[model samples]
Target: MRKIFTLLTIATALLMAQCNQPEQKVDVSPISDATVKKVTAELVKQHGDSQKERIERGVAQVAMLWRITDGTETDFEQFCTTQFVSDDAALEQLFNKLSYGFEMLNGYFILLSKELMKPLHLDWGPVTPIDELFGSYNAAAHLNDDLYANKIAFITALNFPYYTLKEKTEMGENWSRKQWAYARMGDMFTSRVPAQLIQNFSTVNTNADTYISEYNIYMGNLVDDKGQTMFPADMKLISHWGLRDELKSHYANKEDGLAHQQMIYQVMKRIIDQSIPQQVINSNEYKWNPYTNTLTKEGNEVQATPEPNTRYQHVINQFKALKAIDEYTLKMPNYIQRKFEGEFELPVDEVEQLFIDLVSSKEVREAGKLISQRLGRPLQPFDIWYDGFKARSGIPAEKLDGITTKRFRDAKAFEAELPNILTSLGWSKEKAKFIADRVKVEASRGAGHAWGAEMHNDVALLRTRVPASGMNYKGFNIAMHEFGHNVEQTITLHDVDYYIMHGVPNTAFTEALAFVFQKRDLDVLGMKEVNPDKEYLETLDNLWSCYEIMGVSLVDINLWKWLYNNPNATADEVRNATLTIARDIWNKYYADVFGSTDEPILAIYSHMIDNPLYLSAYPIGHLIDFQLEKQFRGRSFAAEVERIYSQGRLIPQLWLKKGVGEPLSVTPILEASAVAVQKLSEKK
Candidate 1:
């Protein structure tokens, strides 16, 4: 019921004893099988052959879910007999009413949820545990109970019996918009998870989010083996994002750039291993020597405790919470199946194969060779984040920061500049104004995010880390990414014909657009790429990016697989397992080129803690972005984007085919990347 435009996260556990638990599937129908069959036949006999198919399906569907408290067998029979609409006009009318009703219900709950999360998400004052408690409180947690109690869920389910993802994909090819909407309506009540369990999931996830959001590292306090401080005294970077971006920015530093990158890599390793001192996390109180693993105060060595595996502990908490949901999801029995087929509209194996294919291809080796030649050195583990291809990479960080801070002194300034940013990307003035009017800008608490509106009139949120001083270059680039999400959100919601088909298939689709916009950040600043082979360079950049994150995603996937297998694993066990998994993936795909066989640098992605299994979306989004960019050749960028997104929520394959005339495969970029590598190498 709650519409969360968040970083994608959801999942849980096992096969042998999966359905054996006594309490599992306790919500079985109290109505007898004989009664259900008899009622179905009677409803069919009354409705005649033309209406017989729907009558039987609807009656049986309702009877199968009827409980003792809901009604007796006789009441179930009577309700089905009276409620079944045989006429086409009548059915359409009923469908319209139900659709409108649900939109109102789901939309307003989303609005409420946004307000509740504002304090935690926004830069509010020091949040108390009570604020976190309220933030976790999902108002729609019990909305399912209310719907079932009032028989709304039963009625909807009866009319539109649930279709599996396979069924939807196959049969949906011929179905009209109304039919697809009805199928989704059927999806509303496939299984009844208890309200308390939903609340539990919400609470667990919220706490994990709070943890990751506050996980900051004081970069200024870090020292090398020789007791040298290399960073600005006031520099503070949050886990993964700030640290990674800082590493990227140093590419222009030339002077001691490698040293800075190595230091950041060491810092990431400490974070991944949970050996970073507890006192140093999110604090500037202590000086740290990451290479030596020491903490000190005022030049005096001090005893500092490690983080005690809180990083992995939160993951286990999420795992256990998600595992508790296994029995409740009957169709897609396990978390993996549900996450891929149900939500992503793709299979896990399929997505994994796509990732694996690209990572293992000849294109990757060629790209790596090109990168190493450009760097004039052997590749390091941290080279996975090579950022030299972009147009702005040559520009000084201070120069970019000066421009960004001067232009966007505050959130309000950025808000006012949205229309211009939009127009810079080929959007007409009227269209730009329309989108900007519905986009709200705000200071974010974490590495920012975009929160889309639920209802038509509500404004979409663009949250970014605008410091008290001003927005920096990193913050500006991220803001552009979030702005892409806001644009997609506004378009899909306000322009789509059906509320049920309002968004793109999943978060990955939005991520694709965000990547697209992010690629154009410099263009928005009137800093066009001067390099002749910019497109080819951009292609290589995306390939390297995909190669890096795909390995990280493999680690995340395999880590969860390990957690499920070792259900009773302790925090320390998972921590050790995580490092092993990360190293294993790195060794398999990245070791030969990087000259490092067991580097756990990939495990440093913060998404693993707060947004499980979501790292895949980024790489997959990059793939889609490349393919879409290919199709967008010679087309008006703004016009085509509106056209593509306006196609609305369809299954991934179908959406890709309609949007780009090809199914989602990495071949486009892989093939193009090979050509790019050859071209750039020939020039050199």
Candidate 2:
């Protein structure tokens, strides 16, 4: 055996949910052990000891997933003997081939899914029942099973033994780009889950996404107890991003600001409590004042029913479907481990701690005090979203909307200026055009998202809500954010060294760049902020907004923990628990700052209902955004963006260290924020 048993054990212990349980060693039949030993001996004799450790680990890892149905022990030995590449050049060649093959298989399937879900994703009239079915369908569900059956999967796994997250983090720094690519290749075939369970997981998540996408609150239909309307008659806001942004916009509202803010706040509470009239969800049949929980249509007050725990139903359904996958992923045994350690490459505990450090910081109380002083009033629960840092927040909301609507007019009009938008951010025209040409913009059914191409030739899709009238200020801002993602996607995909490594480490890194672009939305529109204290305000903005999202993310994490502990929790049980968790987080971190206790405002994120465990990215992204912003202060924005993003999919800490000067930490942001608070306080 090779002298690296420790790494092999670590590599094999890639359990999701951080299951500390011992990995069940593959109980190979005696014949199997004999065959593996025989193969390793011969391969060592042929390849020499330099390749000994890798050969021993690779052969055993592949054999671990092998079954009697995959053929007799003799067949396994024969396959290994035939497949094992002793020559270094040949093995490298095989890895490259596998990488390209995977790109094709994964890429085309993703594109197909994107096309099939177009009806559900795009604002193409109305979504049909069949569209939901198609959208929920996992087009690539059988790809894994088929690959396993065909032995291609076994071959890939044999050549490229999967490295565990720990092993990757430990050894990845010393690895060459190709070696890292090979390790990522090893990640391809770690599980042998049935296709049906995967389809169920897909269906549950798809349903949740659909539920959230259609969950529009008719803001215009929202009325106060005194029967006054504040929003535009045609305005329908999606919960809770649209509603949240709309609430943020009210900071600029001189006359009706506080009332609109209060109204939106009430609306959020109703949704969270499931007390919002069911009729007002995605319908214009009635006007409702969320404050009194009252419903009316035209001149007549109407009867109403509450939304029957559908939100929590989605959460529990996702919990059930994903939990079923736990038994199959014996290495990473649960969804929590799979999501954080596997997908995000972030440990749940570490992510949670980072969040708590920010939310529970003295900086948050200082930020709240700053907002209070500025508003000349005490903090409201909704003031967690204080949006005064951005240049547009100082401009009248209507004026900014006018400027954006005039500039964009429609999705195509915005699409036409993609290059100009990039150039405005200091990119050279050539580079801007290169990226813009490969990005396609479209109107979306939901708030919006950036969908990157899995294959290089494919264009990145930027989807954002463009109302029938025009692209409003909110839409433009989101589009700019998505555009940032698209740029990252294109650069990391088209310009990086390896197809397998062609993306940021995780969504947060992309989001960091997106936030960077989003902050410059005013600059892109020729409305730059001239405030000398703007940078300090921006730091406070980053910290405070991060504080708000951190609370929500803590709720998300705790809710998952609750689900895992109580696997059979009913929808109502999950609902009640979610509220309790939200309030607990709020009280722990936010009560003193916001002067509220048991506030369920933390439960208002739509991501919790649909995105499951994804809320953590926003806060982490904000931190990354702030740190990356620090990097660009004395540097060229365009150059650093290209250089930083082109590094492509290293682990988070490694990527941060290489991109910025430090690892992913709150110390920089917290320190800067303390100074910012002092400076701002002195100015006041």
Pairs that clash in candidate 2: 15-331, 15-332, 16-332, 16-337, 17-337
TM-score of each: 0.95, 0.95
Cα lDDT tens digits, model 1, 25-83, are: 45778778788788778877887887776666677667666778788888888888787
Candidate 1: clashing pairs of residues: none
Q: How many steric overlaps does candidate 1 have?
A: 0
Please report the candidate that would top TM-score against the real structure. 1
Residue range 53-141, candidate 2, lDDT tens digits: 78888788777778766888878888888888767789878878877887787677777878888998898877888999998787666
lDDT of each candidate versus the true structure? 0.82, 0.82
Residue 278 error for model 2, in Å?
0.9
